[model samples]
Target chain A: MIRFDRASKRYPNGREALSGATFEIREGEMVFLTGRSGAGKSTVLKLIALLERPTRGLVMVNGCNTAALASRRIPAFRRQLGVVFQDHRLLTERSIFDNVALPLHAAHAPLKDIDKRVRAALDQVGLLDRAQALPLELSVGEQQRVGIARAVVVKPKLLIADEPTGNLDPALSMEVMGLFRRFNEVGVTVVIATHDIDLVKASGLREIIVADGKVQDPATEKLVVPSMEAER
Target chain B: MSGWLLRHVQSALFAAGRLARAPVSTAFTVLVIAIALTLPTALALGIHSVRSSTGEFANAVDVSVYFKRDVPIEKARQLAASLRQRSGIARVEFIAADEALKQFREQSGFGAALDVLEGNPLPHALDVRPKTDAADPAHMESLRRYIAAWPEVELVQIDSDWVKRLNAILDLLRRLVLGASALLGVGVLAVVGNTIRLEIYSRRAEIEVTKLVGGSNAFVRRPFLYTGLLYGVAGALLAALLAWTALQLLDAPVARLAQSYGSSFRLLAPGWRELGILLGVGALLGVLGAWLAAARHLARIEPRS
Candidate 1:
């Protein structure tokens, strides 16, 4: 679960990235964050990840106020969450297997268990055959899948993806979304930030539409689900 | 794999293997460190050699007590005889004024120059050697005062200046070695820092990804720190080799020099204690350099996500 209670973020140069914003993400929910550029979409995820603290109000992740935790403990806290970047930030120097095994290694997982789990996770994203292949040698879609395998390899309770399909074709995007749907079906909470309205419309998941640093709609007072079906 | 020590050592060795993948650069860096470490080690050996040699010279000490010309040779002989019997006295020789004059005339090449002198101008003297314990500068001064104040003694010439000068040189050498080692240690640190920095720069993206995956700063710095330790250990070994080789190169000539002075002294490498200190200090410096580099750079790099 994640909470941004009346949170706001302001850059030092006086740019208001997020202002007086709020939302709650419950357990095992698959939510889509649909917003335009500079609409605080990435900033929202960053707040939950403890990569950046909010300027005003509290940001809580899994019940702990992240702003108050010691900087050193942040890494352990982060290890509990799986994050997939839009750039498919796979370590290009290593094979797909090693890249996926990295999170387990950070946790100091046992060697045999790590090998088994990494193989199993790679199998989930359909990258098992490419396990020995380096990221540079993989196609873009395959590399993104490697990123997904790496993120979920640790069996994180929360998964955050920022534009997972930003560079994929329509077919690849749909496939990736289906893969995320499968993870969510297995009780892994997912929040994806994207500008892809068409993909959001097709996915039929709960959507939170943010614009100009604020969520729009009457549901904003309670929960702005961003679901047009609710309005109907 | 978790509790196995071989795993850690294997990882460390694997990390070192990565360094060896670029053999030329690794060799060059190790060579530079070795040379840096060797200079101070060689200086230490040299200082040790000088100290021991001059220590041997410290044994060549004596007291020259001059008697009044009117003192009878019999009186001077009695003084010498009893001085030799003193607890710490090694030997005491009596030289009557005539005997001194005869020896001077025999050795002075100007044999007739002393014949022009009247009444055996030189005074009868006693050359006294004390026990080694009483040969120190302070104790020698005390003995000189004690002997010169004797009724039969007119003057005492205990030439401690050469010994004092040698001691001063030894002290200066010690200070010089310390100063040089300190300076070179800084150089070693700088070398390690720069090496770690370059490694960090090359692996910057890897570090970013690691941090993003929730790797601690300690995790990211582990390999680089190992690399520095490796450098230090390798450099220390190389320095030991260089020091031994230098001693070997100087051994024959040094032995000849010793023989010229009626000695059997030989050039020797550092003893075990000094070797241990060298190895330990080198590794410590390596660790320190890596720590400094890691503290400065790892804090600045953040996860891009």
Candidate 2:
């Protein structure tokens, strides 16, 4: 569903965040993006989201080279995928229902359909009862669920979640991962970038490790495994 | 969304709702604008009324017919009556040679000295006033020439000089009104522009969010434009009302002043054309201010870093 071919992003003041990184993500498959801090994990997701343009090489999502998509068309490209961030990025001023309904609004969905889908998505995340509550009134985990509900409300074909479990306790992290797994089971392709090795291992999903502005095949990395507290 | 667009028109009717939201502030701003716009408009209207009334007073006096010295009082009186019956003549008064002399004695401070004279020195005359249209220069000249050729008439002196000068004064007053409105119009634009600039600064966060959500520049500008248009309509309406009231307030005083000067003049407000100019200037000031602010600032913010 997505491909990054020798993509490199260089900031103006000589910050090379990504360099000659080559990778491919197939359709309807869930992949774990494992990397240390500053391994260019967020850059990869942003590239797919078309929030930032790559300095060189082609990045394709859903059969179109996003590097060539006009700025105005970026919203349409983003609508094709659901995005869950570590920060949730939910608008605190609005109710949970409104936050989740944003993606549909961006797509200019019919009111009836937007309402129906928003309820259904919130129900799937078990936040239907709190739909009218503002994000600031909700717990951090619930806020993350609101973000998840927003991402999936449009039923996008691809889901790119950056550090989805970064700010959560292990229990809540597992629960959120379970939600992503459920979405994946319904033929939605999922890519999660995380620093939590234990959580990634617990999911038993294929891991693609990134380090020092480069992506590597996990099978080829022979470095000692970084130990993690499984229970923590 | 089309559905949101329809339903949210109720939501976007923010001009009224926003005013309702902040009544005191809204009223304060509106009053400031109205006062700013009203003073000059009222002055223009007063000057216009004075010019029109003074012009009419000059035009109303009409022609003076100096009869032949040998003509009798009865002949002059008959001539006055006939002129009063003329198609365009409004009023005519006959002055007998003796009556003229007697009035001259009273006004010239020679009442006692005039009795010392053996014969009346003043000639018999007829004062004729024409209708408004007949007071035109060409028409007055025609009437003067026609009356001057009469055998019983010794001289015919038509006074249209005051009419010419009144017209010149009126033209100047009109130019001054236009100049004042123009200067104040620039002031209005600056006021709206500054207000919009403050609005843009205050709503910067909301704007960034809108852009991040894929809103176009036009979408970002819609609310501010609406706000400016609101200020314009509101300010113009208040200015018009204030001008009308000022005219009403001055009508009695102005009429009394004219009466003291032996005139029947009254204060007059602007006609339809001036009203159009007033509203047009308001709307124009609003749009220009909004456009200038939008062009200056909104274009600088990128959607995302």
In DockQ, how does model 2 score against the reference complex? 0.30
Model 1: per-residue Cα lDDT over A1-232, one tens digit each: 9887888999889998888777788999999887776777888888888888888988989888988989999889888999999998887778889899998877777777898999999999998998898899998999899999989998999999999999999999999999999999999999999878888888878787677787543344664454542212
Candidate 2: docking tier = acceptable
lDDT of 1 by residue, B1-305 (tens): 34356446755896698788988887777788888889989888887887786786567687889998788888888888877776777778888888888888886766777667666788998888888887877878888887887898999998667887888888898899899889989999999889888888888888888888888888788888888888787778788888889888998999999898778877667888877887898788887898899999988998757
Return the TM-score for each candidate structure.
0.86, 0.78
How high is the DockQ of candidate 1?
A: 0.59
Count of backbone clashes, every candidate in sequence:
0, 0
Residue B255 displacement (Å), model 1? 3.3
List the candidate 2 regions with Cα displacement exceeding 4 Å. Answer: A34-36, A75-81, A102-107, A206-208, A217-232, B1-8, B14-28, B44-61, B64-123, B126-160, B244-251, B263-288
How high is the TM-score of chain A in model 2? Answer: 0.93
Summing lDDT over every window of 10 consecutive residues in candidate 2 chain A, give the lowest-scoring window.
Answer: A223-232
Clashing pairs in 2: none
True contacts kept of each: 0.54, 0.17
Per-residue CA lDDT of candidate 2, range B1-305, in tens? 56867534633485466556777876776777778789788988777777766764665756889988888888778777877777877778788898888778776888898888888767899888888878877788888887888889998887767777877877887888788777887878888888888778866765654554445566667667777777877888899999998888888998898888668888787778878877777777777888889878887765442
- Model 2 gets an lDDT of 0.79
Q: Pick the candidate with the highest lDDT.
A: 1
* CAPRI class of candidate 1: medium
Say which candidate scores most in TM-score. Answer: 1
